[model samples]
Target chain A: MWLYFLKRLGLAVAVVAIVIAALFAMIHAIPGDPARVALGPRASEELVAAFRERIGLDQPILVQMGNFYVSLLRGDLGRDAVSGEPVLRILLSQLPDTLYLVLGSILVAVVPGVFLGTLAARHRGSLIDRVTSVISVSVMSIPAFVIAIYLLLIFSIELQWFPAIGAGEGVLDRLHRLVLPSLALGLAWIGYVARILRASILEEMNEPHVRTARAFGLSENRIMYDYVLRIAILPTITVLGIGVGHMLSGAVFAEIVFARPGIGKLVFDAIISRNYPVVTGAVLLTTIFFVLVNLLADLVIAWLDPRVRHDLAG
Target chain B: MTRNTALSIRDLSISYDTPEGRLRAIREVSFDVARGGITGLVGESGCGKSTLMSAILGLLDGAAIVESGEIWLGETDLLTLSRGEMRRLLGDRIGAVFQDPMRSLNPVLTIGRQMTDIQFRHRLSRRTKRERAIEMLHKVRIPDPAARLDRYPHELSGGMRQRVAIAMALMAEPDLLVADEPTTALDATLEMRTIELLRELQQEIGCAIVFITHHLGVVSELCDDTVIMYAGEVVEAGPTRALFEAPRHPYTDLLFACDPARIRERSRHLPTIPGTVPGLIDVPPGCVFAERCPERFAPCGRLHPRPLRVRGSEAVRCHLHDPEVTS
Candidate 1:
């Protein structure tokens, strides 16, 4: 098991490295002048050159990448080109909001999604199953932004239940603002989770163990929850890992719609302003977060299913 | 003979709604199992033996519909009970051992947890449940029951897991134990051990056991009475020894001839029944087995023969076995 974990960690490190390099190259490749954007369009060529030198962009791409890696190793992410503040500090401050959004969204998706999915599976061919199936399919078909806009219009504009365009007053207020956006993003996610869980549970229900449990005279509820759900939920762990990655991306649109000051909004601002440091920092942080979330999911899956760990260990 | 019947099925017919339409899986299958007797229901795959067992336990999923039947356990008709009532009766009064032990046991949970959950559901106290689980584990002959209690299903071997499942079923000392191909998945030695263990457990508990399997050898070894099913019908039933010695139904004879031991004893070319069991959707009008029966007569394809008692307690459904006919 230790060997397998080490092997997976090694693979994860390699993947993160590749992702970082690609992101760096892609950011550089975009047709824009970060120096001009930093110093303003009216600045002379000399002023732009000075700003480029100050931000270390005057160096060759390879040298800049080398310095980025070196500084990363030393826990420094350099200063933002526009604000001239430490990129690491900005990221550290914003990281919690993003974490809160991801965690909250996942909780919102998983609980109701699993319950509804199991219900659909148990009451298969019933009206409830059909309705849930249709709803899930419809929710999954629509993009996150569309759902976010629809939620914003209904919950914020018409219903007036939540604040329209900003994070609310206190911690509770922030959580309240987070509720609508999280639900918006998680609506589609819940659909995906429900569908996956429903399929898995249906498949599991047919397994010999399920029949055995039923034969044991276990209540339908007990059998469904204990035997059926336990086995069925294994694959959902993998889906959840991928879902975190998806949720992070979805949070970008959600952050824009809700005007929440999360990493997604920061990245969006960095992209619009062409702030290389901020963009790179935000992208790299999000990538790392995605990788970490996936790694955690892998570990969770291994914990739930010994077969996976045994296979990995072997 | 005075012993109470553990399970009594009368005119039990089960059907299911398929894409094609409603398809009957079992038709008018009736049998009674006396307390403490190991009654075996044997047939080829898709012959509704498993379906019959599922119907009896009220475990049939959404697709299956019990068309007409009275599954009586003691005085109560199990078929008439609500889901809540059935749930309460299950595990406490009737236990089931399934075919695949690995699938039957929860992979994520420990043996102790699985056993204790059943005990707890039956309202046995936690401490007593633990002790009873360990005791049951010991009874099933699992080595180092204490250490094994912590182990998950995957950690144990197939045979050991099967024993654990058996132990769980026996925990409540249910009045009726339904074993559906319990030994089919085990090796030769494990199979023998399981059969022996089951026999010992049955003797101790004195519960009526309904053993469902396709293997005649298993039935001969473990069952007191035998019911041979063919295409959703009971074609033959009698005491195990009597049925094995003189199988009246052509299907039963074919089943015995197909047995490895029986085939080995017959120096001539081994006999095999041609064709598969008919699909439930398009069952032929007359006898379901007429297409496959080698000794099928002209009337065999035109007349459906109901089960008729021949001699003693033996019953056969073939025209040849009819008392009015002389072969």
Candidate 2:
């Protein structure tokens, strides 16, 4: 198991490196000069050239990429083009807001998804199962943006239950303002998690060990929650882990919709002005986060299923 | 229902409502398990041996309908009990071991945890439960029972898993143990050892066991009374030695004829009863084995024969044994 962890850690590093390279190439692929964009379009050629040399953009692309990699390793994410501040410091300020939003949304998705999915699977083929299935499918079918718009209309615009604008001040203020956005962001994924959980648990219910449990006189609740849930929840954890990237991306739109201060908003602002350093740092961090989430998922799966340890060893 | 019997099954009928038609899985089955003795229920595949066991356990599939039956354990009819009542009875008053040990255990849980979970309803202390678990594993002859407790099911071999299954079932010291082809998946040597272990456990625990299997040799070695089933009906039932010595039903005689151990000389090909057992959808009105019975006579095809008491405790369901209205 420790060996499996080491191998996965190495693989994650490789994935992050490849993603950083891709992000670098993709940023350059856009038909715009960051120095020109930072200066006005009407700026003189000499002025633009001096600006390029000042930012080290006058060097060859490979040399620029090597410089970016070395500086990234040294914890210097470079200065923002528009703001002229250290990108890492700016991201650090934005970090907690994004973490609160993303983590809140995931909690919203997982808790209800688990309960509804288990209920659906328990009363499978009954009215509850049919109703839950229909609800999950309908929710999943709708796009996240559409759901976000609808939630904004109902809770913020029509009902006036929450403020329709930017993230509010203190801890409680942020939590209160986050409610609608998180729900909007979370509903689709809640449906997905429920669907996966329902299928996984239904499969577990048919396993021969469940029959043995029944014969052993274990209560239905004990069988479902303790025995079946323990085995079935592994796949759900995998889905949640893989979902970290999706949740981060979803938070971009959510932040835009709610006008919140987070990394998503920072990335959105950076992309418009072609702030190369900020955009690169944001994408790089997202990739590293994604790779780390997937690695954690793999480790969790190995821990849950012992046969996986044997397979890894062999 | 019968007096002083550990399990008394009377006129039990079960059918599956499939899309094609209603398949009669078991029909008019009756039997009794005497206290502290093993009763072997022997038949070929699809002869409703498993269906009967499921009926006894009250664990039939969703599509199955128990048309009529009374499964009496002591004075209480098991069929009349509520689902909760039946659940309480299991692993306490009754225990069961299934055919495939490979799939019978929860692969994710350690053996010790599984055993503890099985006994959780009894409200025993954690320490006491662990002691009982180790003791039961020792009873099943598992080596290093204490260390083996912490291991998962996948870590154990098929035979070892089966021993753990037996130990788990017997933890509550049930009065009746239902073993449904428990040794079928085991190799020959393991099969012998498993049956021997069951016999020893039965003797020590003094529990009535309904041992279901296809191996006649096992029945001869372990059972005091034997019931031969055909197409879900008990065709012949009596003391094991008496039925083997003088089988009243022709199906019983044919079954004995196919027993390789009873043959004095080895043959190139083992004898088999010709023709497949009729499909459950269209079970014949007369004797179930009439089509396959070599000694089948007149009146064997048109009219159904009820079980007729022949001699001692022996009963046969055939026209030859029916003394009334002789043809």
Q: Which candidate should be chosen as best, given DockQ against the real structure?
A: 2
User: Which residue pairs show backbone clashes in model 1?
Assistant: A209-B103
Candidate 1 interface CA RMSD, Å: 1.6
Query: B106-213 in candidate 2: lDDT tens per residue?
Result: 888888899998887767798899999999999999999999999988889999999999988887888899998999999989999999999999888988999999
Estimate candidate 2's alpha-carbon lDDT, on a 0 to 1 scale.
0.88
Candidate 2: true interface contacts recovered: 0.66
Q: Which candidate is the best by TM-score?
A: 2
lDDT score for candidate 1 against the true structure: 0.84
Regions more than 4 Å wrong, model 1: B1-4, B264-270, B325-327
CAPRI-style class, candidate 1: medium
Query: Which lDDT value does model 2 have at A19?
Result: 84
lDDT of 2 by residue, A79-155 (tens): 98777799999888987888888788888889989988998998889999999888888888898889888888998
The true-versus-predicted C-alpha distance at residue A306 of model 2, in Å, is 3.8
